[model samples]
Target: MMFEPTIWIGAILMGLSLGLLGSGGSILTVPLLVYIAHEPEKAAIAESLLIVGIVALTGSITQFLKRLVDFRLVVVFGLPSMLAAYFGAYLSQYVGAQVQMLIFASVMVLASGFMLRPISALPNSNNTPNSINSRVDDFTVLQYLLLIIAGIAVGTLAGLIGVGGGFLIVPALLFIAKATMRKAIATSLFIIAMQSFAGFMKYTYLQSTQELSLNVPLIILVTVCAVFGVLLGGKVVNKLPQARLKQVFGGALIPLSAFILYNNV
Candidate 1:
């Protein structure tokens, strides 16, 4: 395949969004693959899972090193998410591509709503924009169970739509786990990595059985560009006005989601 600058540029931007805004940025991946790279719909979704998973894993590693990640939460939330994500991928083959795009677009709209809401509207989080709050309380039995269920729900969406579900994941971690904003964000990255890989694996299987093959080299290129963006984003994450950034991102997503819906439906 010929080199595509659009895809690479989009990948970098996607990474920057994630690095700057957290997981919400990954919602851009499927659209980038489908519209810019011109991959088949199923292939784009699969490729998205792989690309997002790799980037999430890279971010998770850094968060882990900073002692920001909570492994206890990762195991509790990540496991169910991974399994549900696999099932979501497997289910996707039975659904039509147009329907999948519709679902993906709708999810983007929902994600934008999440972004548009005031941060205070969600669960109370002990956090400031700049500092990492790694402290977490022991979960109640009910909290653990709710987290497992939330994981399944988010993972299913992640697998089916090729989104990391970070917009949903961070909120769930905050509300259900009563985790701080920083910890929720950090833990959400780890969960996204695991579930995305699981979703990717199922899509890989579908590549053989359903004949929707992935562009491995393109995936690699996109991942590299995105990671570079993440690094760049990391350098400036604290400098930006996060609330305003989120508002801009949320507003931008509305029209983009509409365009996607228009094209698909």
Candidate 2:
């Protein structure tokens, strides 16, 4: 692929957003892939899925090595998510690009709203690591069943757009699994990486003739930049008030969604 400065800029922004938000940032990737890289909608969506998967994996691996992952929940959510993602990819093959863009924009609007909500805190007693250790809380059958349902919904959204579904996953873990905010974020990243990989593969299999229309060199540069950005973002995350940060990040998506919808339509 030929080099393009525009795509490079887009990728840098994409990485920066991911670093800042931890989720919903991948929502930028598809639009950037289309408008900046000048790729067809189908190709852009497919490639964006792959890139987001890679980025999420990179961030997740960093978190996982710290033993932050909730693998049991990941498995419960991921299985149904993968299956739903397959159906979503199949549906995308038949849907019009304009319609898809509209749907994608709607999903972003919802995600933005979700992000803007007040951060829910776990009980003070439960917040302690020792308290958590004393309780041998395994997933109940009900938890597993609920996860499958949530996964189907989230995976459908991810497959419909190029999002990694971290936005949904984070909140779901908090509300459903009753995890602390830190645990929810860490687990969200892990599940997002898994779901993105599954969703990307599902879409890729349905899609023939993968297109690399974007500036590959620039993509590499942006990916490299993201490594540092995520490190910085991780530091920043600890310093900032999470509610304020989430609101700022969530509110930004409105204009972005509007712009993409307007231009694409």
Task: Find the candidate with the highest lDDT and give its number.
Answer: 1
Off by more than 4 A, model 2 = 1-10, 17-20, 120-137, 209-222
**How many pairs collide in each candidate, listed in order?**
0, 0
> Considering only N, C-alpha and C atoms within 3 Å, which residue pairs clash in candidate 1?
none
Cα lDDT tens digits, model 2, 1-265, are 3357765656656655555556766777777767766667776666666777777767767667867666766777777886777677667877877887888888889889988877654232135564333221566778767878999998887776767777788777766776655666666776766667776787667755433244456446656655555555655766766678778878988998898779767
lDDT of each: 0.84, 0.69
Report the C-alpha displacement of residue 212, candidate 1, in angstroms.
1.3
TM accuracy, model 2: 0.85
Indicate which candidate wins on TM-score.
1
lDDT of 1 by residue, 1-265 (tens): 3377788788998888777766687999999988888899989999999999988888777778877788878888889999999999999988999999999999999999988987776664447553333233456778878989999999999999899999888888777776767677778888999999999998888887888887888889999999988777767876977677777888889999999999997
